[model samples]
Target: MLNRMSDHRLAQLNIAALKAPLDDPALADFVALLDPINALAEASPGFVWRYVDENGADATAARPFGDDLIVNFSLWADRDSLWNFTYRSGHLDLLRRRREWFTRMAAAHQVMWWVPAGRIPTIEEAGERLALLRANGPSPEAFTFTDSYPPPSAPPTTAETGTPETATRAGAGLTPPRPASPSSS
Candidate 1:
């Protein structure tokens, strides 16, 4: 069992369904931004680790979910660190433009939980968390930005958690842009 108080970090795993094949020209812009944004995340204050594939690329083609889905699993110092890198960094720009290259997922596409500080989460573990979130909604075990929970040591309170209203307003600037017509080249 992992203990929250003993150097554990927050882990986030998000899966996105591609609107078009990554090589498609319509998604060129999104693909182009990957390197820079990933570099930014790695350099961010709270960043600990990010899953990379055999090609040493960001796990964009890793499809533990399916061939059309991509996974981004990373570890951060804490919730605030992840939040800052995600919302207060260049990552937000890509997030805002996601609809152009990714489909709107009807199910929960993102899930976050805590992990032992240096322990990286396996794809199976990430999948389990995503499933838990999809089936049970937000909980300390697995949650989202809108419905966050505190670490085990902290008391669970609305004030401490990121409620839907607050998350919506705070992340408004990062909302995905309107969908664009799919293109192959």
Candidate 2:
């Protein structure tokens, strides 16, 4: 049996196209919440690392993907850690209001993958994963919360049961209820 406590970490990259300039009055609310929300994430359990720009600011102005896009790239101990922080923490507040600040993307804008513990992925690598997901749909190499794959080191059978494990340990069969789509901001 696999150790199941693999030393791999889960990495996530999400991009959102901005509806207005960061300093624009239309975005004032979103901008104002950035620092507090980021602080909350840093203090959250299982928080590992987040991408910051040269000025030690959030990666909003990095523009690695496009001039109008902001990226959130981070790592966690496992999918459960990431899921908890994303859904069970203050992050959900922002996520609920995303359309107020971001354009509705026609394609997938988030991707998740596994990396060796302590390894940080580059922006280019994140972009590649997103591209792969868009082109190939979900795979073990790149996936989404709705269609996730297991970590490479996961055991074939559950530790508590001799039966084979058929679903991801994190999120399992729970799919988030998609909020009604609001027109792009």
Candidate 3:
């Protein structure tokens, strides 16, 4: 499945905009849709990691900005894996019916970024990154596909002879850089 190829790791950040308080009785429906999709993804090939709440909840704090809006957050392995689950896999089936379960967002409600192979970013950090993208365009710390950034731990570097150990693949759909070595427990 898509997850297998995604074993290398990446992050797919997601946000869902909720409907007006008076109209948002579909929270149950939202969970129903996501729970299955999440299961499928976890079972998929490249499924390395995901972000969950303190109790290992499926969804974290549903930050309500107003009576009409709530923001949700999640992290995934890679853009391609997420893409498969989102647009090409069974999840897409629900996406086609999103209006029945979700509100029409006024802006781009989700963004994706590449994190180091095993890093599990916190929600606060995710929010900061999103805000940075909104406020400062793109840099190594926060960026988007249109103007990508490298993972903060390391960006492209060159040898003394200037032969880059890493090359700039920013904005070219490259996976985030992996650490020089894996961590030992």
Best by lDDT: 2
List candidate 3 stretches off by more than 4 Å. Answer: 1-8, 20-28, 60-77, 137-185
User: Candidate 1 at 142: error in angstroms?
Assistant: 0.6
The digit string of per-residue lDDT tens for model 2 on 25-140 reads 99998988888887887888888898887677677768888889999898888888889888998889999999999999999999999998879998899999999999999998
Q: How large is the C-alpha RMSD of every model relative to the true structure?
A: 18.0, 14.5, 10.3
Q: List model 1 lDDT by residue over 106-178, tens digit each.
A: 9999999988667888879999999999999999899998998765443112334432221231233333335
Q: Tell me the TM-score of each prediction against the true structure.
A: 0.77, 0.80, 0.62
Candidate 3 per-residue lDDT over residues 146-165, each given as its tens digit: 66544433333333443324
Predicted structure with the largest TM-score when compared to the true one: 2
In lDDT terms, how accurate is model 3? 0.56
Compared with the true structure, the alpha-carbon lDDT of candidate 2 equals 0.84
The residue-level lDDT of candidate 3 at 184 comes to 95
Per-candidate local distance difference test? 0.82, 0.84, 0.56
Question: How are the candidates ranked when ordered by TM-score, highest leading?
Answer: 2, 1, 3
